[model samples]
Target: MQPLLDAILHGGPMARRRAMAKAITLLESTRADHRAQADALLTALLPHTGKAFRLGISGVPGVGKSTFIEALGLYLIAQGHRVAVLAIDPSSSVSGGSILGDKTRMEKLSVHEMAYIRPSPSSGTLGGVAEKTREAMLVCEAAGYDVVIVETVGVGQSETAVAGMTDMFVLLQLPNAGDDLQAIKKGVMELADLVVINKADLDPKAATRAQAQITSSLRLLGLHGNPEHAHHDDTLWHPKVIQISALRGQGIDTFWAEVSEFRRLQTANGRLAARRQQQALAWMWERIDAGLKQAFRQHPQVRRLLPAMEADVAQGRVPASTAARILLAAQFGKAPETIE
Candidate 1:
């Protein structure tokens, strides 16, 4: 553990990248001993973490997210910033595997000495993020990456967890996105700190229309959803809409300018620190809930009765709620009759 820590904290660039990968892999392992060591490593890395700006990017499947990310990453690297991209690829439910082809997609940035890209399988985790993505971000930050980008699996609506964990959430859209009212209705749009219309060069007029429509939608949502936003406070950051052509590498500088402005405003208002505090508490509760569920499943009594209860529920002999109650009672060492 000490050697891995040393490599990650002080090794040369190649060794540091290797150590980061190994540390992230350890964090992803399900073995009990691995988990203990991962926890210790995380504790040691905590002080070095949080220095980097965490940026979360998500969009629908065909929105050219990979292209946009590669362009932005290269642009940042050229400006002397060390960039780390944590790309989440969806896992197959049947086979529980992912193609993990982000490295190939981001050919130049992936091989750059100043950039690190880690493609993680979602592994049945919802919200379009991998289970250990936050841990991986910490590893990258500890390794001196000043900009960390988390690219989600591009699942449309339910792709929201990234916003909670990231300092900024940028949602990508196609030029034709505004043609459907469904885009405005998606909950993911409400969470976006900035909306970028990618591939705008394909249809400039359509992109302009989308920019207007989305800007209006965001304004209306803000007025109705949050009183603070309704006031249009300059101190508080409201979502902005911008157009970009990632394929042509246009508007990347403009996008970065908006990001810088958002960060400046967030820092000035102290919301950045407050947001991190809230996220830390939320992460703790999320982990607790997950741990409790795992413990419930592993409880000897619950495991012993689970098969019969599942059969009963499947046959409609027992209600699922009742079966759940009975299992909970058994896990707590109470008689099943006590559940009712």
Candidate 2:
């Protein structure tokens, strides 16, 4: 393990890849020892991170997400960019395993020297991606990867969590999927930085019509509507919509060019730096919350006090809010002292 850790710090291409794979495996481990080592490795790797662009791709099931990523990833590698994909398949709560195997679909990219593909089980979390997805991205970047693509499970449910963590959120859609234009939730569409109309070569005519309908629908999303002729900022910027055939490798270059241009504009406008800062702050709070939860559970006094407080509330002897205050005070050994 020490040798592997050392290799991670100063290894060549193959060694680094090996270290990365080991690091990711440790991160995904449920054991405390593995987690501690993984945390240390991540701390060491943090400085080399934040140099790559992080993009999140999400959509409904059967949206060709895995296929599109394979095509796009290969394209990027051909352009001399080292690519890393963190594919998250939401785990089944009953069985706690993945049904859709992203790695199997992306066999080519998985073996490419310039590419690394990791499939993470979502562990029944609210976010489509796992909690460690961000950490995985950092590991890849630290290994000198140029681009990090996060692919979330294709469920049309709310994906605000993944969207908030990425530089750009790409929404993928198919042709003539039963008026998908009307069925898509507005909030989901608003989060999209780019929309790709995939499977274009399967049925060109149908794809074209579907593209037009989706474009028109997205345009409507960008318009501010009001009954009293008073319009608020009820719309977001229109996301670029591109037609692509991921299987045939059509329009991939054009799609990537648009994405690169959007990235450039975002950086020039200062949004990129701003977003990174926000993500950092969010991560800080997340860890703090996790630590607090762990501490509260492990502290002997809190463990004893929790049941008593719950019983008091249940029996109507104490209000739930009052119990919460007491618990907080007990856990911190005081009512939370404020610096301000």
Candidate 3:
């Protein structure tokens, strides 16, 4: 593990790739021992983490998210930046298998010397994000990747989940999306720091219209509507809409420029630091809640009574509150007094 840590921190690019992969695999493990080792590795690399730019991208199934991401990845590599993409694929609800096919999807970018592509399964999470995505991002950063892009499966509340973890959240939309704001929920739109109208080359007019409609709709939401909108007057960053044809690599440079601008403004205004602090606290609470639920489910007494309590409540033989009290009390080694 020390050798691997050294390779991750000081080895040449070629050696770093394998070490990075091995380290990330450890981080993703559910085994109790692997988790402890993963924690130790994270402590060793803590000083190197948080240097990368975290970006989250999502869109509808046909919105060209892969094309856009690969295009942007290639462009960033050409600019001498090492990129890490955490592509989250939907898993089979029945078989619990994931195709992990993102490397195949981004053929050129996947093999780029300056890019690392990893595909992870959602494992039944609504967001389709790997449970260890945040840890993986830290590992990439520690391994000298300057850009970490987390791509979600783009369904339901997944977009919001991605936004909660990344420094910048980008939402991609197709040209026809202009006709119906209903295509994306208002809540999701508000989450975006920037919006891209992809496949714009297919219909120049439609793309233009979509950009206008989205920009207008954003303003109506009162989040990114005003150009002067800022957390502070000097470092204001008003979200805006842009058109791009990712497959053809059109607007790729402009896209990066806008992203750079967003970073600059956020970094200057202290919002970037503030947001990351908030995310860290939020992540802690989420894990604590999950741990408590797991402990409750695995408690010996609660496990013994849960099924019968559930049945009684379901059949109206007992009230839900009474059943809950019974189960909770059982966890603490005391029986609740009976209710009428």
Best by lDDT: 1
Task: List TM-score per model, in order.
Answer: 0.91, 0.82, 0.91
* Cα-based lDDT for every prediction: 0.85, 0.75, 0.83
Give a tens-digit lDDT track for model 1, residues 9-89.
Answer: 998989999999999989888799999999999999999999999999988776888899889999999999999988655
Let me know the TM-score candidate 2 reaches against the reference structure: 0.82
Clashing pairs for predicted structure model 1, backbone only: none
Candidate 2 residue runs with Cα over 4 Å from true position = 1-6, 30-33, 92-100, 121-129, 154-158, 220-237, 305-318, 334-340
Ranking by TM-score: 1, 3, 2
Model 3 TM-score (2 dp): 0.91
Winner on lDDT between 1 and 3 is: 1
lDDT of 3 by residue, 154-268 (tens): 6556677788889999989999889998868768888898999999999999999989998988777654445465243656777789999998999999999999999999999
Per model, how many backbone clashes are there? 0, 0, 1
Candidate 1 accuracy as lDDT: 0.85
